[model samples]
Target: MIRAWKRFAAYVLISLAILVGMDMARADAGSTVAPAAGPGDAARSWAGHIAALRARA
Candidate 1:
């Protein structure tokens, strides 16, 4: 019936939206946007290592 079809369409749209939002969030979660630091920046290097460990956890 038309009502059933509409419900199915709505469910599919909502599922697609959730999938897209999760993908976007995960993509952003994977990396930092900070400018690259030189090798002399020990603090930045340590912070980067911590971030990598946290991401793995």
Candidate 2:
């Protein structure tokens, strides 16, 4: 029983470590791109068109 408990604990710690490493990797992978107003403006325009179509429905 003790041996089983030890193995379980080890597995849990290793899993947690792997998850933390993945999270760190993802954070580091995040974009460094500067935000532009053009994309937001385009999206807003598209959304307005969609809303208009939805209103017709």
Per-prediction TM-score = 0.52, 0.52
lDDT per residue (tens digit) for residues 1-57 in model 2? 999999999999999997665444434545232334798865764455455445545
Candidate 2 local accuracy as lDDT?
0.61
Q: What digit string (tens of lDDT, one per residue) describes model 1 on residues 3-57?
A: 9999999999999997665445445567544445776665664575566556757
Error of 1 at 22 (Å): 0.2
Query: Top lDDT: which candidate number?
Result: 1
Q: Between which residue pairs do clashes occur in model 2? A: none
The predictions' CA RMSDs to the true structure, in order, are 11.2, 14.4
Q: How displaced is residue 9 in candidate 2, in Å? A: 0.2
The C-alpha local distance difference test score for the whole of candidate 1 amounts to 0.65
> Residue 8's C-alpha lDDT in candidate 2?
100
